[model samples]
Target: MHQERLTKLRNASPAVLPSLLQCDFGDLRSEVERLQAAGIRALHLDVMDGHFVPNLTYGMPIVAGLRKLTDLPLDVHLMISDPAAYVDDFAAAGADMLTFHIEAVPEPAQLIQQIHSHGIVAGVALNPQTPMEALSGCLDQVDAVLVMSVNAGFGGQAFDPEAVQRLQQLRQSHPELLLEVDGGIKPETIGPCHQAGCDLFVVGSAIFGQDDYAAAVRQLRDAL
Candidate 1:
């Protein structure tokens, strides 16, 4: 891991990453390259297991394939039942940072340690309805906090207003934490999140759904 790049990413005015869920997976490499050219430093890969979340999405195989294509850091968000069972595999698959749902794991500290043991950054995620209490005693245990602005398991859903309060709480309490807001993040919602102190923004369809990737990314950056 390059500490400088990680530091730059964390300290960036606001890091905007376009989620690959809305991309054309048939030509994933080209799409990722396009995103890179558009000034994206990291890629957000949402890993969903049919049981934890309603939908099933990408896994280690696709992550590994993506690793072979881009040099950008891979931020793999694991929305699965037993994340502990597969952290090492995802790390081996070239994940630069691994985030698992607090709703899925009981002892977040142990899982955080497990993820760090693989020499990758560890993050904890909270769904829209899940309380911050679920993150008790573990706020200091992870590298980032992924605040799901919409229900998990799907992309392009509308932003939930309750997430703004959640972001406020996390920001006020952990000012140094790498705060990230995902789901339904667009030019309209990014401002609220940025004002709430979120530095890492994940834009899905708002960027990938467009004809010009660079222009879309510029709009997101300009909003911040």
Candidate 2:
């Protein structure tokens, strides 16, 4: 697919991405359909293993189940110990974008190439302590960079506003990279990240836990 396809897929103002995360598997189809109607073009799936992030989330069964939900693109974050071990599994599970922690595998660039070989976009994530300098040479190899502004194991944590400056420096160093901020994103916090050059912002509890999901999505979109 063309790179521009991502920009054209959603109707949100400012052309920013609002990726829904920590979603209820029971109501996924309806939730996805509602997001589609609400002008969302992508969903962020947080995958974790007990060792990597102190939490165990979903695997093949749930990922496969979600593949049936919608046509909107899926952004799969692998918070596992050995992400490279399951690259093809995630591709087979229908992930449009496969993201893994930069600290996971021995070779970040090669695994990214492996994902792209599967014909899916590849992404690398940075934990609260992982520096962008670690991604130095491979910056061009990954399609996106996910910066976890809050610790990964929990939700509803406060946004680390300092991430805005940290991400800005990284964005300045690699302007073409697709920057995504995951964790504690609300209408108030996202604008600062946007100004700091984040292209996509991931929000979980702020959207799904709200009484009105679509309205929340719209508010985030408008705020961006």
Candidate 3:
């Protein structure tokens, strides 16, 4: 099942995944409906623990809630201190993919195996300041790698030009890996990231902050 979903995502290469963190949680179902109508292929969920990133976002309940709302792939980003402990919980909550911060894990390969054990795609994420060398041992083992364009915790930060370099390096080294870019992914910055080698763009404010979600998505796609 997980492989099928991953294949579906790969088929829609360079897909736009609207971040739910910026959506109207008061009316989440409608927000999801709007995104689906706007032609989104997946949804990105940011789960942050206060200790790891100085911010607290939603947890399993929200994941489950979104699971109940739509069948679109749930790409859950775990920005926490200990993601291995929550692997089963998030997978049970219906996450199709679970990406944990490489900086937070001592045994990234083990954690990646743990996430895969749950029958879901596992990804490793690196913060803007983290060197690409940090992912050396586990790069080829995981299904995806999320290159943070900005710091992890916040929602509306500026895109870091360094992230494009990181994406390029990863693409050059591992051409088959799914490269995802998150944070500061508006029309102006997204094109360069895509050119550099990003298979998935996790956009937040660019779509949610707009009056017309469909138009916002179309504009971003046009930029790509």
Candidate 4:
């Protein structure tokens, strides 16, 4: 059933920035509106903490506020140490897709189960240093796998060349699973990622920090 749902999202209307990362919390409503107007179908929310990733991002208030900004789907990625502790909060905050790192939580499979219980798509994120094999026995419950190309915590980092081969390996092992690529996902790198079987592309500073947000989305989409 989860697989079927993911397939539906993949086949949705093609447009600019299928995955638009909203890192700048400044004027949350305005930014969300601009992203939606720019033809971004899905919004990627990066949740961080000073612990796991050396960064501190907003929590429930931002999520609650952004919920009213646009009707577009929200993709929440938790880069915190204790992911399960905030599962219910994020779920109640209106996240359509919740992805927590596989290496952070104590019981990842159980966390996925709890996320599912909340009626949202549950996904797992693997850091740049983490092996792809870490997702081994827990693939079935996951709706997606977020492979971090840069060390998490901040944006605008270089896209790792080694990630390409690793992405290919993930594609080979899990054809049914939706693979997502995050961190430093610029226009030129998108093609190879798609070719390597990454269905979802999460771009943060590439779009948010641009002169024209809408144009950035178009450039990323057209390049891919």
Candidate 2: lDDT of 4? 43
Candidate 3: list runs displaced more than 4 Å. Answer: none
lDDT of 1 by residue, 104-186 (tens): 88678888888888778888999898878988778987778999999889755789978888889998998878889998898
Model 4 / residue 85 / CA error / Å = 0.8
TM-score of each: 0.95, 0.90, 0.98, 0.90
The model with the greater lDDT, 1 or 3, is: 3
What does candidate 3's lDDT look like per residue over 1-224, in tens digits? 76887797787778999988888889998999999999998999999999999999899999999999999999999999999889999999999999999899846878888888888988999999887888998987899999998999976588899999999999999998999999889999899999998999999889989999999999999999
Winner by TM-score between candidate 3 and candidate 2: 3
- The residue-level lDDT of candidate 1 at 200 comes to 88
Ranking by lDDT: 3, 1, 4, 2
Kindly report which residue stretches of model 4 are placed more than 4 angstroms away from their true locations once superposed.
1-8, 12-24
Model 2 misplacement above 4 A? 1-21
Rate residue 101 of model 3 by lDDT.
Answer: 90
TM-score of 4: 0.90
Which 10-residue span in candidate 2 carries the lowest summed lDDT?
5-14
Candidates arranged by TM-score, highest first: 3, 1, 4, 2
What is each predicted model's overall lDDT from 0 to 1?
0.86, 0.75, 0.91, 0.76
